[model samples]
Target: MRADRLVSLVLLLRRQGRMSAAALARELEVSTRTVLRDIEALSAAGVPVYAERGRYGGFALLPGFQTELTGLNHDEALALLIAGSRRGAQAFGLGSALASAMLKVVDALPESHRDTAAGAAQRLLIDPDTDLLSRRTAAEDVPDAIVAEVRRAVFAGHKLRIHYAAVDQPPKWRTVDPIGLVTVRDQGYLLATRSGDDRTYRLSRILAAEELDEPAQRPDRVDLGQAWQERSTRFRTGGDQVAVLVRLHPSRRDELVATALTVLAEDADADGRLRMELTFQDSRHAEWALWQLSTSAEALAPQWLRTTLHNRAAAIATRYEDSP
Candidate 1:
């Protein structure tokens, strides 16, 4: 920890030119005495650290001192390059530059490590597949430029004029003040405020986005994290509400009861099967539960659910019967 602090102190001085002991101590979570000692240790190791006295007093590194990156071995260097290349491409748009830098780093490695690195690289492929975009329909081919602009506006707290495609409705232009972006599985979403109401728009549905010249402001009481959490909870709970009783093997009973659908009651049968009463939000959810229980459990409640299950089974059997 002390060594880490000393290294951080040196880097801080290099970046900021000078820093007082109190400032360094606060950043490093140490005392002024500890910072002073670290400065002395750095100076002893020929770091050229100097301290000035008085109100403007602080530690500074001598001019022309260079920091070297000699600690990383070949494998470590290759790993860092790969990680950096992936991040740079995804986050910072430094695609080809990152790849070129990685090539140079890999070429500089020794023959043995280079061979190992090549094998590792081949085995650990990080392909950002472009094929998924091909599956999108004409309606979904919203420009990447528009998406990027919306993302920037959201981060910058700027208002946006967007041409959006609403479900079962014609495309219309709307002005929204973007709060943040939400990523749901493969799709990106914008959570925004429009006319005092919160709205979520799919990225693919956005036809165009124009950033307004006015600076953006957030509502004092609005919390994006809390809003997303509540939205998720409501979505999960809004499905069909039905009580279901199922008998599961004793071994799997505990796991079954621990699912999101609450277990209202439980009983152990003489034959070692555990009967559980559970509630499901919808028929689809109930069907999913029954599918999971196939061969291992039995539904014991709501005759309609059992009938639906039987009908589904008959349809599935008909499909197989019609198969070659």
Candidate 2:
């Protein structure tokens, strides 16, 4: 808390120029004594902080203080601004601030570079799909504070206490040593260890979190990227790895074959019917795919899957037939 307060004090002074002890205390929600103490601490730490007494008196940094923005050329600055405006800016609560900052940087650049930067900004457009945006769940809205804490734990090898809720289960608390945070399509996940077992927890499901004092030294020989790859492979291979054969009309073959599932084999008959072998992880997803294909595709599976599909089809037909 004190560290955060100290950082806030510095940023506030940088933006507001000068602030009285009473004003700083009110803004920071700290006592006047605490404000004085903080100012003393800052001054001792070579922060260029100064205090004055009486009318129009307050604390301020010495004149002509300016923060430098370096390393970005004109093109680079425009690209950075465009990228930030796309989605990262909104996700990180830096949109307006970033725009303002970029404007200042652009204005400071030379004429030619500034023009190029302006042109790039005008041409850059990030058109996110409206349908996809609407489908994003609440789990996609991870708070910045939790993300910061997760990063700190990962860097410091500290353990963390997290309150997480899985899809179906009620919310529960766990103590974990965070390994990493992964950004999926729209959501963020925390990969962590619980009593030596590793699992992924959705950041959106985290009700609360705090860093613990205990440090869990990571294995010197372990490669995090490799470990994550292995975990991903296992997840993809989990559940029923069933092989199903389907016959599709030649007209529908291209559409059916374009899905992510691997095709094991294929054959075409003279009658324009095409037979293809496919592997799937679960019956539900496979069935959904077949349903999407409608009358054009028929599953010729491990007998059980075929029978299940047939039974479902018959039931659906009967329901319609029995309805007036």
Q: Best-fitting candidate, measured by lDDT?
A: 2
Worst 10-residue stretch by lDDT in candidate 1? 88-97
Off by over 4 Å in 2: 1-112, 131-139, 220-225, 249-274, 302-324
Assess every candidate by TM-score. 0.47, 0.57
Q: Candidate 2 lDDT, tens digit per residue, 75-147?
A: 3343365453345443432333344445456645765686688789788756454556586343256666766
RMSD of each: 17.7, 9.5
Name the lDDT value of residue 222 in candidate 1.
64
Worst 10 residues of 2 by lDDT: 67-76
Give the Å error, residue 192, model 2.
2.8
**TM-score leader:** 2
Candidate 1 stretches with Cα past 4 Å from truth are 1-143, 161-175, 184-187, 199-227, 238-243, 249-270, 277-281
Estimate the overall C-alpha local distance difference test score of candidate 2.
Answer: 0.69
Q: For model 2, which pairs clash?
A: none
> What is candidate 1's lDDT per residue for 136-237, written digit by digit as tens?
322233455686688668756788989999866999999998887654434567788788776788887888889886666566456768888876666556
